[model samples]
Target: MNAIRIDIENVTVAYHGKVALHSASLQLQAGTICGLVGMNGAGKSTLFKAIMGFVQPAGGRILINGLPIRRVQKSSLVAYVPQSEEVDWNFPVSVHDVVMMGRYGYMNLLRIPRLSDQRAVREALERVEMWQMRDRQIGELSGGQKKRTFFARALAQQGKVLLLDEPFAGVDIKTEKMMIHLLMELRQTGHTILISTHDLASITTFCDQVVLINRTILAYGNTSEVFTAENLSRTFGGSVGDFSLATSQLAPGNQEEQEWT
Candidate 1:
């Protein structure tokens, strides 16, 4: 088996007095893409935040390559791309500058980007096909372009583990396909990726493993084993029959007409 790159062991998270996650545990092997699936407010983002060290767990711990998250972060072994909505588009930074921020982890205290850093930034941008627009302001680009810029930043970070939250949300089909291809390429190069997404149909298509969660982990394992109707229903809280109806209702044809809860 490949080495474990990310290990979340019985982690619990809370907000104020309410428990958001209850002893959730999952392990991600290196060179694989794992999909984090759940309905809205299912603690998917919370789990990602915990792994990224943005939230202190109430219990348990997260390990990156057998080391603690903080140590892994300091070594630039992990990179995160938050949901687009969480980002401030009016930050007044160029695309190249935003991508260059990934190199800050490797820079000195003065934060001066070296020639190697510039080369890395350039290569990342080119890989995502955003090099031509590197000079453009972030706010000026379309939704897909913004996503590409962030993905490029993650690539430039040169991290072995990548965490993304709702990266495919609100993206066009072409853009979604492009991102999926990029992720596959990254996986081939031995990068471990965990992407939180609501597109259940894409799980089988893109992920080698799936972790289903609702307040706590409902299921976690190979995609074929965990993404079944039964597991999805347990995660989403409905009968298999209801799940089928709900899934059909949320299909691409009806997605624009109805809002997903």
Candidate 2:
């Protein structure tokens, strides 16, 4: 069997006496992009938060590279990008400042950014093609630019795994292409990536695997085998399903309050 990069076994979560996910289990291999599809309230964002160590699981554990996730944080092995709206945009900060924050967790409390950290930030920004806007205030940039800026931040973390919530929700075609290219390059570097998205078309072409989730794991495996219309219908049986929402509506910057984690 292939080596597992992330292992979520029999994990369960709840909020205020209500359950979100029940006995969920999944194993993601290293160096592949995994797409998550599910209806709203299906525990998708909750799952990502669990992996980020933001929300504690009520049962079971999440592991990274055969080690507990709590231990994995020491290496900065996992990085997360919540939806754009989740960020407090009114906060005064520049694009460079945002990207540089990724390095803080790796640095000593009193340590200033070293030459290596600056170089890494620049390289990451360049890869996302956001270097030209490096000094620009993040609030002034367009929607796509903001996404790219955060993506560069994730790249700067140099984490072995990246978990993104709606990376392609809002953006022009050019920006979407750029994001896809960056993700592919990361895979080549042996990074494991997981994205929660509603774009079935891109999932067909860009992901190595597809995980169908709705309050529980419906299916997970090769994209070709798991993203069947039957599976989609099963995952989205009601009009309230998350699939019906346009990608435009799902953007982190555009969604309703408390939609992102």
Candidate 3:
């Protein structure tokens, strides 16, 4: 078993006087891939934000390898890939520029790219197969390409932990397979990966651990133990109906399947 890389201790986050995530906590170990499953507005993103220090928790604390986020950030211990919906794809930026942005944390105040930074950017883009289109406008790429571009940005950070939100949302099958393969490889290298996805099949397919959430964490543990029908039904509430425990699959209960699945 890998050592614990992420620790969340009874964290509570509120936005504009409304609590988003309350008393949420979990520990993620290095070299493991954990899935964050929840209904919409269930604080998956809030949990990610709290880990990245994007939001000040209303209560409790978070630690990376036992150090506070502030202390670990300087070491680039965590990297984030936000959901596509949160990005402005129309912004005038090239694929190479975006990937290079990840290296800014390691650069001087002027943010000029050094030889090492350039090498890191090139390697990241190449790893994601986006090097061929390094000069292309980010908005002009296909959905999968856009996703890969940002994924490359995260890779350029060379962080120990990777936080990806809805990575498979709009990607093609090929892209999905590629990402899964890459994530598995990263895990072998001792990178702890956290993914927030609506894809139920994927949770059982790849994640070693699963975190079920609905505003607060409902259950979290090894995939088979925590991803049972009972836990999923509770996490998704009235929306989740059928589950093949054998496969850890969840189907919606609504007359029509919810848009998320």
Q: Estimate each model's TM-score.
A: 0.90, 0.91, 0.90
Whole-model alpha-carbon lDDT for candidate 1: 0.84
* Candidate 3, 132-201: lDDT as tens digits: 9999999999999999999999999988899998888778888888899899999999999999887787
lDDT of each: 0.84, 0.82, 0.85
TM-score of 1: 0.90
**Cα error of candidate 3 at position 79, Å:** 0.5
Of candidate 1, the 10-residue stretch with the lowest lDDT total is 252-261
lDDT score, residue 24, model 1?
Answer: 95
Report the lDDT tens digits of candidate 1 across residue range 4-26: 47789999998876787899998
Where does candidate 3 have its weakest 10-residue lDDT segment? 252-261
Model 1, C-alpha of 46: deviation from truth (Å): 0.7
Lowest summed lDDT across 10 adjacent residues in model 2 is found at 248-257
Question: Which whole-number lDDT from 0 to 100 does residue 95 have in model 3?
Answer: 96
lDDT of 3 at 1: 21
| Per-candidate clashes, comma-separated | 0, 2, 0
